[model samples]
Structure formats: structure tokens, C-alpha cells
Target: MEFFADIADVAQVKEMQEWLPLDGVTTNPTIVARAKKELFTLIEELLAACEGIVQVQTLAYSTEEIVAEAKRLVAVEPSRIIPKIPCTQAGLGAVMRLSKEGLRTTVTGLITVPQGLFAARAGATYVAPYINWVDSMEWSGTEVVAELLAAFEAYGLDTKVIAASVKTARQFRELASLGTNAVTMPPETYKTILEHPLTDKALRNFADNWNGVFQEYKLDSKLKG
Candidate 1:
């Protein structure tokens, strides 16, 4: 499974690079704004930072407009970019065109399994279901993930499922358990995964027990070797 860093700032992107062993990034217009950078500039910066795919979303309201913009983004580095579109009819059409043209597409804003099914039919490279949002409505994200995965596989859809809007560590684990191929985690939540009780206790115990003899040697080893 792929762990996608969902962040807005270039600083956070750089931090993720140095810390999180993630697979890719997931971005929307809001995330771009949060980064406090221009859309294309942020995309370029993020693309440069990560070795994996960088998803740049389309904020266009119509298929034609989005497709035009998507074409431009894809022209920059088609293989490295995943064009994210909404899970609407117009978005679906744009995604289908992009998919057929061999541009990777991620259909986001998914609320229901049927919407994901539509995205799958459009040959979306990834389907992002809003799992946390579903949970807020007292719905099951797991059911949606499982259904989409099965439907995509059984019907020969080329689309992959990416569970989105993941909040807590439990939600993250649930998404993974549900067989999602990828998930987008907010920067804070991603950091939280490293702060579990076991990790904290282990670090604390090591720090309390250490006599500091290995610090210099470890630093030298890291720097020299």
C-alpha cells in the first residue's frame, strides 16, 4: 500500500522527504493555498522534492477547462503527475479523456461507492473516497473501500482505490486493512503515527539509560559513512 502525504506547505513537503517514508503526495486547491505558494510553483517544488508521484489537482468547474489545464500540467512531466478531478459527471468525462490519452488521473471528492464506480469506469488511475467524511455521517469507509476494490477488480476497471480524509491513527490503520492501495494523511496525523506509546516509551527508555558515549560516534558514522 502507498502512503501519500497530504500537505500544503513546501516546508512540510521537505520535512516529509527527510522523515516519512511515503510513496507520494495528494494535493488540492486548498492544500496549495495552505502552502502559501502559487499553484504551478508549488507543484513544481513538490515534484522536485519527492521521488514518487505528485498529484496536482484541477480546480476547474467544467470538463473542457479542466482537460485543458490538465493537458498543460501533464505536458510538464506527464508520468510524474496525477491529474486529480472531482467525482462528477463533467469530471468523469475529463478523467476518461485523460485516462484514454494515457495521463494518470485520480478521481477525488468521492462520497459514495457508486461515484467511485463511475470513476473506475472512466479509467481513473486512482479513486479517492472520503473515508473520514463518511465516518462523520455515521457511514462506513471500510465498506466503501472493500466494495470499490471488489468492483474495480471484478469489472476489470483499471482504477485503484485511495482512501482519503483520513484523520486518526485508527482511521489510517482501518484504511490499510480495508485494502486501499493508497491513503492521504494530513501532515500532523502522519507525524502522530511516529508518536505511539511504544515508540515514545522505547525512546524514553533509551534516552534515560544512555550514558552519551555513542552520540559522537553515531554522528561521525552517519556523517562519514
Candidate 2:
């Protein structure tokens, strides 16, 4: 499974690079707006820092406009930019066209089995299902994920499912256990997953014991090599 940072902030992106083994960054117009930076410039900077795939969503509505915008975004860094198309009819069409043109695409805004099926049919490299959003509607998001994965396997689709809109560490782990291929969540979610009071306590105990064992020994202050 792969973890992606669902952020556009430069500082948070840098921090993820420093501490987390993230596969890439996921960005939408909303996230871009949060950064208050020039769109392309900010994405380019993020790409430079992470040196991984950066999924940038298209803000256009029509199929032609979506394709055009995706092209422009990919122009920033062709090999690393994966244009994210919404899971609408036009977006699926754009995804099909872009995939045929040899550009990778990620279909986002997915929430049901039909959307996931269409995304896979459109040749999307990744299908992002808003798991948490689905749950908010009193539905089983992981069940949708399972159905999508099952469909992909039965039909021999190569599209990977990216469980998106994750809110908690338990949800993240549940998706991981369900065999999700990827997940993109906020930086805070990533932080929560990496930290625990028990782990901290255990580390402190180890350090204290090691220090006590070597308390009487001291190394020479000078280096001779």
C-alpha cells in the first residue's frame, strides 16, 4: 500500500518528506486555494520537494477544458504529475482520452460502485473513493471499496483503488487491512498514525535503561583515525 499527503501547504509537504515515507501528494482546487500561492508554481514546488507523483485535480467542467487543463498541469512536470479527473461523465471521457495519450490519470470524487466501474473503464490509473464521506451518509465506504476491488479483479481491470477522505487512524488501518492499494489523507491523519503514547513510553524506557547501563563508561573526547 502507498500513503499520499492530502495537502498543498509547502511546510506540511516538507514535513511529510522529512518524516513520512509518502508516495505522493494529492491536491484539489480547494486545497490549492488554501495555500494562497500561484497554482502551478505551488504544485511545481511540491513536485520538486517530494520527487513523486503529484495528483492535481482539474477545475474545468467540460471534457475539452478538462483535457486542456490536464495537459497544462502535466506540462509543469510530465513524469510526476497525475491529473485527477472527477468521476463524472465528462471527467471519465477526459480520463479515457488522456490515458490513450500516454498520460496517467486518477479519477477522484468517487463514492459508489458505478463511479468506480466507470473510472476503471476509463483507464484511470487510480480510482479514489471518498470513504469517510460515504460513511457520513450512513453508508459503508469500505464495502464500496471491497465491491470495487472485487469488480476490478473479476473483470481484470488494472486500476488501483485509493481510499481517500480518511479521517481517522482506525479507518486508515481498516482500509489497509482490506487490501487497499493506496490512501491519501490529511497531514494530521498521517501524524496520528505515526504516533502513540505507548510507543513513546516504550522508547523512553529503552533509552533510560540503555543510559543507565552505560552511565559509568565514557568515550575519549578526541577522535583519532
Best by lDDT: 2
The CA lDDT at 114 in model 2 is: 92
Clashes of each: 0, 0
Query: What digit string (tens of lDDT, one per residue) describes model 2 on residues 158-196?
Result: 999999999887787788888999999888988888899
So what's the TM-score on candidate 2? Answer: 0.90
Tens-place lDDT digits, model 1, residues 22-98: 78888988887767877888788878878788888888889999899889887777778888888888899898788
The positional error of residue 50 in candidate 1, measured at the CA in angstroms, is 1.2
How big is the RMSD of model 1? 4.5
Off by over 4 Å in 2: 207-225
**TM-score of candidate 1 to 2 decimals:** 0.88
Question: Candidate 1: lDDT of 117?
Answer: 90
Q: In candidate 1, how many clashes are counted?
A: 0
**Candidate 2 overall Cα lDDT vs. reference?**
0.89
Q: Which ten residues in a row have the lowest lDDT in candidate 1?
A: 216-225
